[model samples]
Structure formats: structure tokens, C-alpha cells
Target: MSTLNFRRNTNNFVSGSYDKLIIIWQVYSNNQWYCQQKLNGHSNWILCLLLNNNDDLIISESEDNTIKFWIKQNQWVCQQTITYHTGIVFSLSLNDQQSKVISFSDDYQILLDRKWNVIQKIKVDKYGLRLCFINDNQFIFQSFCQEQMQIYEMDNKTKQYRRMNEITIKCGSNFDHYSFPQQYVKSKCLLVNKNGKSVNLMRKKENGDFIIEKSIEFDDQRIYGQLGQDREYLITWDNKSKEIQIRKCKER
Candidate 1:
């Protein structure tokens, strides 16, 4: 269940909670949204919401540090009390592939593979918030600490989670991390730094090093921009006037 809205596309059963009342809605064949049921269960704000991979199960994490798991046929009931965190649960990620779950909290610790029916927990240095699966066996985690970004790589080995390595992305004013799937290209990641009148395109090497590939600096600050789909067809937005400009990369 979501904070303000929760719905499933399989049965089209929608539910939302406000204050102490949880309202469930239904979508009919007429292509309209309507309320169908209301559930009054939680007494706090709903922070994180999740629907299981099959869409048959639902799990929610609240500011109260309680995780409620509910099956679709029944009302929202507490399935498990994951008292893994000392403080509030900020983020939750599940590794359904390995039958494991990961939860990051404001308490500056990482709970790894908590759903694997094993009593094991992996903790890292910084407080991890967002996570991305690099592969079926590995995961990329990011932590925000004191204006710096810390990146960690978590690998599942022998059914146990381990921290392989960690890196820190340099602190820059307009530096942004953009992820491009492997389908576009192998080992492809972009970091664009907007330097007032110039835009720099940096690519991540296979060795995990950032290298500047191209630099586009225009005399007029308004004539440069960072635009592209994956890492290809980067078009510098026309920042000066109505004139249009395009730049395409020709594979060598």
C-alpha cells in the first residue's frame, strides 16, 4: 500500500489511506475510478508501500517502524514485525531472485537478505537509501552523507551477502548520475556536469573510472544542454534563440 494511493493492475483493486481511515477503490469496465472498500487499521502515516512480484501479496512500511504484509483476499493484517532497524525505515528493496529482502534505515545500517529464512544481517559504513540491481548476483547501493555520495557494491555469494567494494562520487554543484541499461551498451554510465557555459560528458570505464569523453562549450550560455536517450544521440538544447542544433555519435 502507498502513502496516499495503492492499487493493483491485475484485479484493479485500489486502496488509499488518510489519517485513520483506509479507503479501497475499484475500477469498472466503464473506465472509471471509484471507491469500493475502506480499511481502518494503522494509526500513523504510511511511508513506504510495496506490492509483491505476483501482485497477489502486499507489504507496507510505516513511520511506526512496522512492516505489514497482507494477502489480497484478506484485509491489511500484520504478517511480520521486521524489527531490524533501530530507527525509522527509510527504504526497502527485495531481491526476489534469491528470495531475499534488503532494508535501509535512517540509523545508518543496511539489512541484507532478511527474507531468506536465515538470521544474517549485513551492515555498511554509510546510510544507504536507494539501491539498484547491477546483476542477478550483484547490487549497487547509494548513500547520502554530509553532502557526499557514497556508492557500494553488494554481491551475493554462497547465499550470503557481502560488501565487495565502495566508491565515492565527487561532490559537484550540478553533477548528476544517469543510469543507462546494459541493453544500450556494455559498462555504460554517464555523469553530466553543467559548467555554466560548458557541458561535459563523462563515461564510466569498465575499470570503474570516470573519463571525460566529450566537451561542448558554447559562447552563449543559453545555447548548450545535455540531452539524449541512453548514451547515444546527445542533443545540445538550443539555449540562445529559436535555432536548433543536433549532435550524433558515429561509432568508430
Candidate 2:
């Protein structure tokens, strides 16, 4: 596989092979990686890719102004192709439980079901950069310049969607768009960059509002700058000392 843009899901890794091909890799329990299947349909660069919870469905967005879905069985095959986006698809999210998937491009939200059928198309002030399912009925969205994260409600039975409200995720600071895998804890969520230097923990209230639970700044030398496994430890790697320093809490 060509080392281009690569994105990871829970069980598999989606990577672009060269500029035109995308392949799905499965990591086994013994820590070995194997190319389970290859998807060969794009004519341009693959911008983003992801796998659903079941690890059987692959969603890829490309600069070709298209989104393609593939199934992982004996062979990787194109299950459906969505060519309605006017611009390049930037991001996508899938809620397997609700059997709904949503994609975002320049200024639209393309909602599709499990069968890869277009259900609705709605316009927002800015494109929805990333999405997180709060539950079966609701999800949260963050944008490029938007200070508040938007909450969207979906009908349980009909899967109809509405922009219910907005909540302040970052008050004084500008929103970060590059980092994903936003961690959800209770009603609160943790947002961090890939480098892990800065971390923000925010909480959502019952009224669909958000507040900053904590904002932490770490040393520049710390290789791993965020909270550790159980949120009970902070790890920092020191190159000069050649040691890993861990700041952990005392056991209760």
C-alpha cells in the first residue's frame, strides 16, 4: 500500500494506495498487519476513509467529488457510489446502531442510510467538519470557525434530523478542526490535538449546553502530553534524561 493519507478506525486501518487505490488493513491479535482487501475505483487522490463498527463496511471520500462504499467479504467490492456532492467530501460519520451515515462537504450534510441511499440533504452555515453520536437520538457537530458545537437530534423511528441547538465548547479560544476521535466521557467530551500538547475537557449539561471542565497546558519537552490510560496519570517523555516520567494519582 502506498503511504499517503491514512485514517484508523477501531479495528482496521484505511489507507490510500498511491493516489488512486485504497486498501483496508486488518491488525491481528499477534500484532501482525495484513491487507485484507483492496478497493480500486477512485481516479484521484483519496482524501479520507473510515470503517463502520462491524468492520465490514468501508467509506471513502475522494477529490473526485464522490463517496464510495465497499463491503469486506471474500473480495472488496463497491457496494454503492454517491455522486451528489458538488465539492470534495471532507469528512464522514456512521452510526451503525441507528443505521444512518452522514457526510459533509462544502456547505451540505448528506444523510444516508445503511443501504447507501440518500435520505436528506441540508445546508448549514459552515460544513460539518466532524461528527460524534451522543446516543441513538442525538449527535454533536463541530465546525471550522464556529465557537459552539452544534447538537443535532434524529428521530428514533424515522431518522429525521434537526439542528436542535448549540453549546459552547471553546469560549475564548478558536475551535480546532484537524483533531478528531473526540473522547466522550459522561456528558462531557475530551478534545486534544495529535501532538497532545494542549488538552481540553468539556462537559455538556442537561439543557444541551457545554462548559469547559478543564484546560491544561504541558511542557514542550513532554513527548506524550495528555492524560494516560484511565485518566488517572499524565505521562511525559524526556529525551535529555532518556526516561519516561509519569505523574500519577494516589490510589484511594
Candidate 3:
């Protein structure tokens, strides 16, 4: 599987694979999981997937340079396909209000509204492996192999987004892998970012500044993990260790 998203308030989850398939799985009361649906639409490897707050909508990006919207009717179906990107869509992020979406690709960073219409398209100097929305009007983008992550904010007057600042991060080498992703915890004001061989943990302050609290280094570049919903643990698996490790959040 390339990417997966668990639906909130439900025992179901969705996964996208490099084989160009999206599978929805449901857990039974007996604790066994079964495939509920298989969505076939993308022509290339699926890179990212996002489930909305209600779990009725799904946003997916692929190496075919297309972004697809799968909506739930009587069953899950592809309601729309966006072909605006010229390169592989690497990542997808939904804002807190679920009103906007941002996608990062090799070519451009495109923003779309709830209606799935293009709001803004930004061409960055360096293409990134991941980008995420911290809030409704703000987002962070990490350029490939760079030690700095760029911040963008929406202008209240023009209602357009512009690059506001950059946060320095740890990148031990020029090499990195795809799909580790950047995750932000709103409740804890925390960000878990994977760049090169390190996972940089940062705290976002109310003043819009970020403080790097810790950077967990690994011997290998392929690290995969997710933060627990309760903001108490981080579970990770890396090629170097070949084991699933869980780390508890410590109060500082």
C-alpha cells in the first residue's frame, strides 16, 4: 500500500496502492476486516489519499498527474477527476474546516475549494515530496532535499495565498523517500515531519512560529509512521530497524 486513511467515527479505512487501486476496508464486530469496495480509476500509482471529516468523500492523487474525487452515494464512486497537474501528484492535504484542499506535485502546488474548483496554482522553485494545511488559511510545504519548509498564508485583502516564511529542519542527507508525509496535530500544536534520515518534531506556536523540539535520526531514509489521534503516541517502522516501534509522547 502506498497510502491509507482511516475514517473518523467509523471502523472503516481506505488504502491506495502502487498497483493503481483504491480499496475500502471495513472492520466487523468480530474484529476481522474485509474489503468493502474497490475503486478503479487512476491510470498510475496512487500516491496519496484523504478522507473528509464526514468520511463520505475521498480525495486521491496519482502518478498519472490527476486528482480524483470519490464520493459516497449508494456506494463509493468517482464523482470527479482533475487533470490540471503536469507531473505526479505527490501529496494531498485538507484544511481543518474541510473547505479547501492543497496538492503538491513535481510541477505545481494547486489549491482547490470545496466545489473542487482551482483556487490557486503556485509554481515553486523546488518541487516537494509533501505539503500540508496547518489551518484553513495556512499551509507548509517541504521542498525536496532541502532543510527548510516553506509557509504560505492566505491574504485577507486579495484572498490569495503567498509565501510568508520558512522553517529550518533537519535533513541529514540529500536522499529521501516518498509517502512518509507531514502530519500536524491541532490539539497539541505539533508537527511530525520526515526529511531525509530524520523525523523532526516541531511545535507550532500561536504567534505562527515553529520550534523544533526534537529530531529523531535513523540510519535509513525510508521511515514510515503516523501520530496517534489522541496525541499520545507515534508508531513508526523503518527499513533500518525492520521493526515496528512505538514512542510515547513526553511532557516537557
List the candidates' TM-scores in order: 0.56, 0.67, 0.96
Better of 1 and 2 by lDDT: 2
Q: Kindly list the per-residue Cα lDDT of model 2 for residues 157-252, writing each as its tens digit.
A: 776888888765432333333323343434224433222333445656677556665544433323333355466665544333556666654432
Q: After superposition, how far is residue 148 of candidate 2 from its true place, in Å?
A: 1.3
- lDDT score, residue 32, model 1? 95
User: Per-residue lDDT for 115-222 in model 3, tens only?
Assistant: 788878887888679888899888999888799999999899998889999989998978888858899989899999999998999999888899999999999989
Instruction: Give candidate 1's error at residue 128 in angstroms.
Output: 3.6
- Top candidate on lDDT is 3
Judging by lDDT, tell me the better candidate of 1 and 3: 3
Which residue pairs collide in model 1, if any? 222-239
lDDT per residue for candidate 1 within 199-229, as digits (tens), equals: 5555656776546577665544343333453
lDDT for residue 29 in candidate 1, whole number 0-100: 91
The CA lDDT at 164 in model 2 is 84
